[model samples]
Target: MEQPLPKSWSIHTRPEVIAKYEILERVGSGAYSDVYRARRLSDNLIVALKEVHDYQSAFREIEALQMLHNCPNIVVLHEYFWREDEDAVLVLEFLRTDLAAVIRDAKKKEGGIRVGEIKRWMLQILCGVDACHRNMIVHRDLKPGNLLVSDDGVLKLADFGQARILMEPGFDGDDDNHQLPVEQNTGYQENVTPPLDVVADAHSLPDQGFNKQVVEDTNREEYLRQLVELKAKRHAVDETDKETNINDGYSSCLATGTISDIDDDPLKSSYSYDAEEGGDGRNGALTSCVGTRWFRAPELLYGSTDYGLEVDLWSLGCIFSELLTLEPLFPGISDIDQLGRIINVLGNLTEEVWPSCCKLPDYKTISFAKIENPTGLEACLPNKSADEISIVKRLVCYNPASRATTMELLNDKYFDEEPLPLPVTELHVPLTKNNHDEDSPGGWHDYDDMGSDSDFGDFGHFKVENTGSGFSMQFS
Candidate 1:
């Protein structure tokens, strides 16, 4: 017997979406979006409908996915519906599990994750990230939960809500077409007037309870008025000589909820980061407040907005570290503490390591005491071989320029050794579904709680001191 849809889910449903697919259940919910597992009415195929409430996140995800269409390692975006006043609903391919589940399940096994399995997961992630980087797209948020896996064992990169395009192919610094529009700057668009035929079709559809036409008209009018006021404010800022920082418009913290909080409650409120202007004449300055706290790069931790694809490389290193040890490399409670954990292991950030370190936005604002003997990567992965540690060292570093590129890591001899990367068909896919639901345990919402009980003594002892100025570290 078919189960009835919950009444609360009605808030996420739209006449157009209901017209095309049968909503089975709410699979995921976040600050600005809700994902539902639905079956297409046309072919009865299962799909995930991601209804995004934030305009900027929706636009960036749609644009990035469209640009990455047909990339095997990346998530597939089927189609989407966007109305002037309604939240954008994106139709996406549904995967059963993610890397987080794999890691979680591995912890229960006798010998832990197989060498071949680790190699395969790492390779797939590199392939997906390589594709994104080659296309000039920076997946600001990269974590175990975002790496979804199919039943056939193919891992695809998902959740591009925080992605940014540095430049298009053959993009010259002087090209105005590459620049983000004012609408993108303000995170809202003007009302888009639909075609007459589309309007007629919408009216022809049966109403569930309320009058659709009247409701849409009223919302559209009110939204247009608000947009006008926003545009006026934006124009005034543009005319000023003072530089405009993206942080001025919104909060730097993407979400106040911790990993534990998100795991216990998936519907927690979240925040968004705005892209700033100026970055070697590219689209714009990328936001530093991206990715989950644990996997965030050193540059991003110190608030470096003028970063590059290296940020993702740092995240890849963290993910790889977790794969090897089944534990997060640097699991810090807050951004300040996150840096402290890194500095505890990798030593202090100095000008000798990365010359441009002084240019970071919060470099001077946040300071840490020097470490006499930093616990190196080898200490973190105690039983792992030198090759494994070497691979990770190539990535998780203070110097963005020094970090290994995706292509370089892909070509590394690590994948060529015995117990080679398992073939996609032979790879073990966890049966647990990675629906972004409060009840399920394998999605972005659940990452914070993973390995929460692990001992941090392996990285050595370090105390985080709260200097009234900012956070600093004291090594014992």
Candidate 2:
């Protein structure tokens, strides 16, 4: 018999150890780990370093990450080693922000991730995924978050070596108990399941059920959260029992069919989603995140056990749908209702297609409504062109086999009709002409020649060149 490896393999040194790079502020974090900003002592330039307790989660994949450092689309790995002095550290390219940061900032304006923007994002992701696939790597947790951008406006695929970090269970929320094997949550969200005591403790607290209104049960966070937030603030409690008794004035008046106590709390209570309600909200199993839940594939919603890359495709489709129309394609409170949203729009799965699916772990319990007459493309995206509508339909199709591959989607007619160009390269310019002005750090050929001020939502320099035929980029 072989001796098993330890869980805490090796980690980066703490309190600013100067090996090759000087440690800086943290940029990203995992359930049990943290990533930081570090500067090269030699040049005083910044770079990102991922420090973990060990490499036990990666097994042999560490070699894979080290081998593919040549790929530009990937976050280049600088160096890796166990600080015999402390833990292990992974030095990498320091990107400015992830897609989440970019999208949140961009959404404030009308022009969110546009069709061209979506293409550019998807195209860059395809390049990354294809490269990973070529190397036989599967980024099981690929979301908008994993796609990152640097201050230089370059998009890079992060977490190629993420499997180690993704070793914990996430998506299949119900099955995982407090005590599960390290292998159980592999490929799922990291450390999603709270310890048994935590989950039990949360539910044990009297759930106030639903509010008096019809929307109470229909809207989970909107109603009770409203009351919970209001009650948490303003209405202070003198006694502990009063604080526990949630049937305070908010519900008291709501039940009387009177609009008196429905005083919307101006002091909005922010629900800490990361709060797990365990002993201290930490060390507890989590249900789902608002962001990752958006891209959950239909099979997972329907309770399918064995799934694969198609899950990522489903999320990609959903994200694309949201980007296309600026609305969530399948927004449901519960898994059953989520399936209904999917069925209503994309049509239910035919038995011939999802034949073996009924045998999944959650299948016996979930009885989804089979919508024979689902809505069509016109109904789904009212103003979208035939080509754009068709693309979304294919992407969100229920049959996993029938789902479009990333490559197939990259060549979609929609992107073709509204062609998106890659980041422009000055490779064609002469060596003399290629010289950028020293005044600008990016070495701009002519910074003053750039376009006028942009509208909030429009990021792409979308201007139709007035050639013989018009070339407008805006969607009607």
Candidate 3:
């Protein structure tokens, strides 16, 4: 009897992948994976082969890509396969360069990225971000390096290594009194099958199949439409379920053991600050010391775990500022230093200024040095147009609640300015020449190479481990 052929592409061995696709050269390497420009042997079609060694990061990126594959602004995941304990090979669409290279090249060759080009790139970035947010996923890491730019001038959001999926719709923090009803998809529960349009045939492999069903664009739109309707229904249900706080802004009697009595916790009375006496009685479930120090939000620095997409908006503001000036707005050495730099620019984070500042976990322990005069964004970007100034200000606003969402930025009047954003092809940003051989020079290879210290603050300690085929690096 002859040996049977592998039923699924995923079951194929490493030699099989090499036989089907010819790996030309290693184009890029990072803390977790190595990237190569390859050609499909059958048709000579070019593609990117990413050898992901970290199991957790690979799965996270795969899940994010599955949910966002149909988004045009997001990088397309053509196909992927895992072989036991071996690296998960992800075949992604070939993109010429990254935004970091484009910006760096512009600064070196031209004076700066043209205003029109900036608008175009920013709009596309926001589109990708909005799609992620709509699906209740947050791209926690948003920087120029991670954004890939194709030869056709199309900006695609790449690198979902640090993305997070929200369990609840939006960031309506865990509430006890107002028990919001879980909005279920029509005839679909957590264990139920996907919609008819999204579900594939019975013969199709359920998971980890190379020829898995690709999500169609129409299916994505329909899914989003249903999500919007579900949110509306949830809102209506929430309105009826909510119980009025008769105490209003004041603290309810602790002795009464009412609904607002902090669940009868005796520790509620121990705090020096009282909610009734003008304190922000917020108890957020935030963790400290996460994300890169430089682009970290003020709330994060203050130890506010109750943050949402607004933290990303704050980071974007920093990136937007850097694009214009070619330098980070607040390049702090440490977490405390980062908070100090923010205060130096946006003024003190006082109780009067930000009512919620007092509620942060670290507020009582940490004391930011008072700055005499806060040099605002206007002073920092003197040449920035009024429209640019306005948008950045809203993004890196002192209050996280006041920060604009990605969708809001898309509608801003800034895009309608004189000399409208250049058409995709008209944009004169840099593009890397595709290399397919060992003799080829590394063009834009360092575009997303773990970023520089200037961009991500100092890396404490990083280790590189060598696998049989490639190497994987881990940051401490």
Which model is ahead, 1 or 3, in terms of lDDT? Answer: 1
Identify the runs in model 3 with alpha carbons over 4 angstroms from their true place: 1-13, 169-290, 433-476
Q: lDDT of all predictions, in order shown?
A: 0.64, 0.43, 0.57
Model 2 Cα shift for residue 424 (angstroms): 5.3
- The C-alpha stretches of model 2 lying farther than 4 A from their native spots are 1-17, 54-64, 83-87, 161-291, 302-305, 331-337, 376-380, 422-476
TM-score of each: 0.73, 0.55, 0.65
Highest lDDT: which candidate? 1
Candidate 2 has a TM-score of 0.55
Tens-digit lDDT string for candidate 1 (1-476): 99865433343456667888899877676666777788999999988888777767777787777767656787877878776556677788888678877887776678888887787788778868876775567887788878888888888888887777754211111222332232212112222221111111111122221123422565445544543543344334333332333322222333434232223221222233334334444344445666677887887766655556678889999999999998789877556667778998999898888766765666765566778899999999999988999999999998776787765665577877776666666667777843334565443444543221223343346576676777644434
lDDT of 2: 0.43
Which stretches of model 1 miss by more than 4 angstroms?
A: 1-13, 168-283, 434-476
Of 1 and 2, which scores higher on lDDT? Answer: 1
lDDT tens string, model 2, 1-476?
99754434323424333556677665544432356777888888787766544333222224435444555566665655443333456566776555544454444457655555555555556656544543434454455455666554455666543321111222111111232233212122232331111001111112232112212343433433433442333122211222221211111001111111211111101111111211232222221211233455765544332334455567677666665665557654333445556667766555565654543333443343466777855686777767767767776776665666654554455544534433312001121212223464421122111111112123222233343443322211
**TM-score of candidate 1 versus the correct structure, residues matched by position:** 0.73
Write the residue-wise lDDT of candidate 3 on 329-418 in tens digits: 776655555666788789887866665566554565455446778999898788888888888898887666567776557557776666
Residue pairs with clashing backbones, model 3: 286-305
